[model samples]
Each structure stands twice: as C-alpha cells, then as structure tokens.
Target: MKPIELMRAEAVNLTEDPDEVCGYWRGHLVWVKQEDADGLWYVRVNHPDGGYLYDGFWRAHRDCTAADAVAEAFRGAELLEDE
Candidate 1:
C-alpha cells in the first residue's frame, strides 16, 4: 500500500481521556492513547460502521507525542485498512 497524508481532528477525543486524540484516516477512525502499564502508545482504527479495523501497539516510547503515535498506527495498519 502507498503512503497517504493523515488528517486529524484537532479537537476530537473519542476515548474518555482528553489528552488522547481521535480522527479518521482513509475512512478509518484512528485513535491514539498511552498504555498505563508499559507507558507505550497504542492505536485503534475502526471502520466507518464502528467495526474494528486495526488495533496494535506502536513501538513508540513513553515520550512519543500523540501525533507520532497516530502516524505510526496509520503506517502500520495500511494493509488492514484496505479490507
């Protein structure tokens, strides 16, 4: 799959955490949040219908910004987005 630019909803946070961010990328709803135990970042991409599109833990360190985490998720889940 080819890479595409990501567009984020700056004021959106699908989860309860206000610090986390959520937006749609390539028709999938992408959300980035930090892990409580490991302090790593993880992302969840849901389809337009709210079905699970992709869910994975990014290799980002605790200091990684939300934008970077979301970008990693988008890049890692490119192939899954096609289905």
Candidate 2:
C-alpha cells in the first residue's frame, strides 16, 4: 500500500512519549509517522513547527517545500519496506 499524503494542518505536540505522539499523527491517516525522539516528531508531510507542548491542535496545511515534501514522502515509503 502507498503512504497517504496529508496537508499539515498544524504542528502537533508529541510531548514526552514518542510512541504516543507518533500514534496521534498516524491516527490522522493522512501522513505517516517516521522518527519520534528528543521531543521532536517527524511527519511524512510538511507543515509548520506548530511549537511543542501547545494545547489544542493548531490548524495548518501541508504547504511544504517540494524538496521537503519529497524527502518526507520518501522516508515514509521506506518505512513501509521495513514493515
């Protein structure tokens, strides 16, 4: 199956738990969660930093630079290979 493309609606707060944080992003079903560590959550889609530990889901869109979006997409695709 191909990875889904989602416009980043806003930066998501992963908090301390990378697993739970990534789970939230994956739950969106738009973008695939890649690496979550050091309080940083990387998504397969492009959006804003949206700051960390902010309350509520900030609203943004997937307006990522072509290069970034491509890179993230590639990473997401690679993850599928491992699975």
* Tens-place lDDT digits, model 1, residues 1-83: 32223353332434434336666655667777887545577778776788875687766665666666666766666634456
Please identify model 2 stretches exceeding 4 Å from their true place.
1-63, 79-83
Give the local distance difference test score of model 1. Answer: 0.60
Residue 61 local lDDT, model 1: 64
Top lDDT hit: 1
User: How high is the lDDT of residue 83 in model 1?
Assistant: 61
In order of appearance, the predictions have TM-scores of: 0.58, 0.20
Model 1 off-target regions past 4 Å? 1-5, 9-18, 49-51, 79-83
True lDDT of residue 44, candidate 1: 82
Steric clash pairs (candidate 1):
none
Question: What is the lDDT for 35 in model 1?
Answer: 71
Q: lDDT of all the models against the reference? A: 0.60, 0.32
